[model samples]
Target: MNLNTFIQKKINKQLIFPFIILAIVSGIFFMSIGFRTTITTSKIELEKAVEKWNNTFTNMENFLEFLSYDNNLIDNTEKLGEILKNFYNKFQNKISYIYFSTSSKNILIYPETDMINGINPNTRPWFINASKNKEKTQITEPYVDHITKDIIITISKYVNGMNISGVIGIDINPSFLNDILSNKDLLLISKNNIILFSENKNKIGKTFNIPTKSERFISKNILLITKEAKGNVYIVTYKNLFLELLPYYFISLVSIFLILFLGKIVNKNINTELKNSIAMPLETLVNEAKNYLNNQTFDSSKITSNIKEIEVLINEIADMISIIEANFQELKATNEELLDAYNEIEKYSGELESTYELFIEKMSNIVEGFDENTGNHIKRVQILSEFLAKKLGLPKTLVRQIYLYSPLHDIGKIKVPPEILTKPGPLSEKEWKIMKNHTIWGAEILDGDPRLEIAKKIALYHHEKYNGKGYPFGLKGELIPIEAQIVNIVDVYDALRSKRPYKKALSHEKAMEIILKGDNRTSPNDFNPKILEIFKKYEEEIKILWDNLNDNK
Candidate 1:
């Protein structure tokens, strides 16, 4: 052959490999785009569901801790239904039932529940496990609820405080949980594909076999994504691995056909289009993929494009920051200790002078927890009530009672709905009416205790205005008891001073001004003239007291 013929043969050989490489690059680019959408969609859905579940878990655990410390529920379950109703309302419709049980009482399920014999919540495995862990929350395997006769999942925590010893928890309805993972592909299953909640209505509460992990092929194009919840339950989603890939494959075929046609001409414009549009992007994707396999940390920024394939690759890389189920750190009482504490509470019923004192302390904390803006409110109320009672020349015994029971004044809030209690804005007329009933609830809570007579009166009639415009009874002037009158002025003063969800914190001068001179919301006429004079007399000292008991400090 001549020199020209040999050069042409060399050129043809080089063209062959370039065509092959172009085919491969085109396939990869479209392939990545195809799978990315499927992966990203599934991942986002799973992440949201997992995040929701985890949040509920954490909140429930914290609430249980609060319950464990609340000893009042030990003897009084009358208000528990109210408390549960408020809590249930706040959690949307996610919670099916909210209940608690002391060693003395069997579990009381909220909503409609049937009385079931031979079922003691305290003796159950969930309660026992939580009691053992005491401080930590525990989850139970899906089981038939004795009251409802439906399969339900439970999360429980043990309660062992000064007056109470028991378990508190919530039951999650599988159907409600299913509604959260609304996508048809999602299935929350318990052990071996026993569907607790399923995308397909017919598949719910039934067994559906998930094909073997290692056997995923075109004929069985299912992709399984799994995250474990407590109690052998799994959040699972089945996505089609091959669905979008075909469309991407078709795009690749078109691109490949174009590349082949362009290869024959090998013109400048075609080369420019091919290099910029296809070759460089594909090369970058390959480099990113390589780095991902080698690198432990993924920077999604490198994915660099909105292409579905890039998204899919980015999501797969995003797996490093996976949602991890958090476990609690705490302790609980033994069965023997629980039993002994229960027995002792009844055994020492007549000797509750000290326990009552303990309850007062906890009630203050509970009140503050219920309303974050309260800030040493019960403490301040006690001080101001005592100071005013002394100023009134009341007997020492009456003064002592005022200080002791003042903290329990707002104890009736347990019956108020949490939505109203924590409202960030002004209540509607109806809500205001509901809010006013807390006084009645408070009185009822403090009832049955002779020592709490002053507290009960304070709770029931504290809001009765000196001008006759206040709530729950609206008894004007001396019709409102002196004990209530004492707390009323103090409650108003402290409320104006504290930062609430709806209002800014007033300066000490502003608070005193609002109380003495009156505002649209408050009236000097609301205060007894004698109590109003005491506030006017000790305004500076009261300011000092408020500044000294800074909650932040």
Candidate 2:
């Protein structure tokens, strides 16, 4: 051949061989795209089916829960049958039968089936499973129905009440599962690889061999979606690969011819179009990142770029923001919990104070009731002590302590003999000495209780004279606690105005006269001069209190 002809033939060979290879690759790519689309569509449909099945299972579970709460159905065969009939009517097509069995082996079946009696339900799998799982509903392994010969699964719940307790069961027919699979070749397999149900009748009740890596076509099996329901695994398989790829096969042939015509021009335009598509979206992404950093919030939904890389980055940022938001919500919940705890502590403190006040009032009543002074004497003493303490410019907390504790000052009188207390005449010197021991007795009674510190001090020292001549310890001047000193004056003033078994009730003016100036019976030197001065100043207020308290008389 001539040299020019040889060169032209070689060029033709090079061009033809490359075109053939490109056509083959293009055909493979188009077919792969079609297969991916088919798999995606199948996955969506499988999810919908799985969700429907899950909803149905949830409905069955809810119904079982409802039956468990029916106390009337438990142990009452007639009521149980009535309820079962209602349940069967409500789900007649989906359920094969409804029955109940008690712990005592008594069985009740709806639709009036004649079964053998005296069979222990505790030995049954449904009862055992329901009893074992006390916290949730239980589902038994699939079994053939004795009457209809249809495959069925039983859902059971344990019933609990005073006199009625047993297991309630409902047999569900899985025939309706075919509608969820939409006539697809789906198998409901147990965890042990036993096929519970299948679209193909022969496959049911057979052991299934799960596909291994070597046996499965990874690309074709992408259409298979496995979902779990009530511990059973469902495998949905899509076949017919060739029919799904037919349209792509024709389109690939057309693409090969177009590629030969436009191959040289396409490469130049592709880079330009790619840059235009990516540039604006990339810039927008950068601006969004800046905004997210600056403001700590980003509208991820607004980021709708078609570029794969930008979309991926946007999704990652959205995930990070979601994590931060979740952490913020958790922190907010923790803060609310802390606030609740603080409020609880405050409520407890107020309740404690109120309880302390109530206890003090009760103790005062016991002492007064025992002493037989029935005209609100303890109440008047508490009021008068509180008034004197405040007028003496004591701190509010100390004044409150004095108010609550002063009423219990004479609790020692309980130890005194009733005859000695109720005597209408002056006592013998020995009896008077016994009466003086009440102060020591009151102190002993109130001691060791940290909550009654003021009560103990007042009870022990209220009779101690300011000049060191009083009974008990004989504490003088500032040596005695101010609480006791305040109560001492108030107690004596109330006693003078009150009618005692031993003495006529003195007038308020006479009581003040004896307190301010020395009398034949008592002297001003017996009280703290400071407390006595404040008392004289507020004597009118004290008289008003006595009059008001005595008004009930």
Which candidate number would show the highest lDDT if scored against the true structure?
2
* 192 Cα displacement, candidate 2 (Å): 99
Question: How displaced is residue 359 in candidate 2, in Å?
Answer: 1.6
Off by over 4 Å in 1: 1-17, 36-38, 102-107, 115-125, 128-132, 146-150, 161-164, 184-240, 257-553
In angstroms, the error of model 1 at 174 is 3.1
lDDT of 1 by residue, 117-189 (tens): 4567666656666777775777765566676666666788876646557777788766667666778877777
Error of 1 at 28 (Å): 1.1
CA lDDT of each candidate?
0.73, 0.76
Q: Model 1, residue 464: what's the lDDT?
A: 86
* TM-score of decoy 2: 0.41
User: Residue 38 lDDT in model 1?
Assistant: 69
C-alpha displacement of 399 in model 1, angstroms? 99
lDDT tens per residue, model 2, 1-553: 5433444455446555676689779988998899888777766766777787677778877877877776665646677677688878887777767777777765677666665365677776678888898668776766666656666667788877558777777776665667666655556666666676666767776776655112223454333445555545564555567776779978998888777656434543544554456655555666777787798767666566666787898788777765765689889999999999999999999999999889988988888777756578888888889998888889999999998899899999999998887777889999999999989999999999798888999999999889888989777899999998888888888888888876789999999999999788689999888888889888888899889988954
Error of 2 at 541 (Å): 1.0
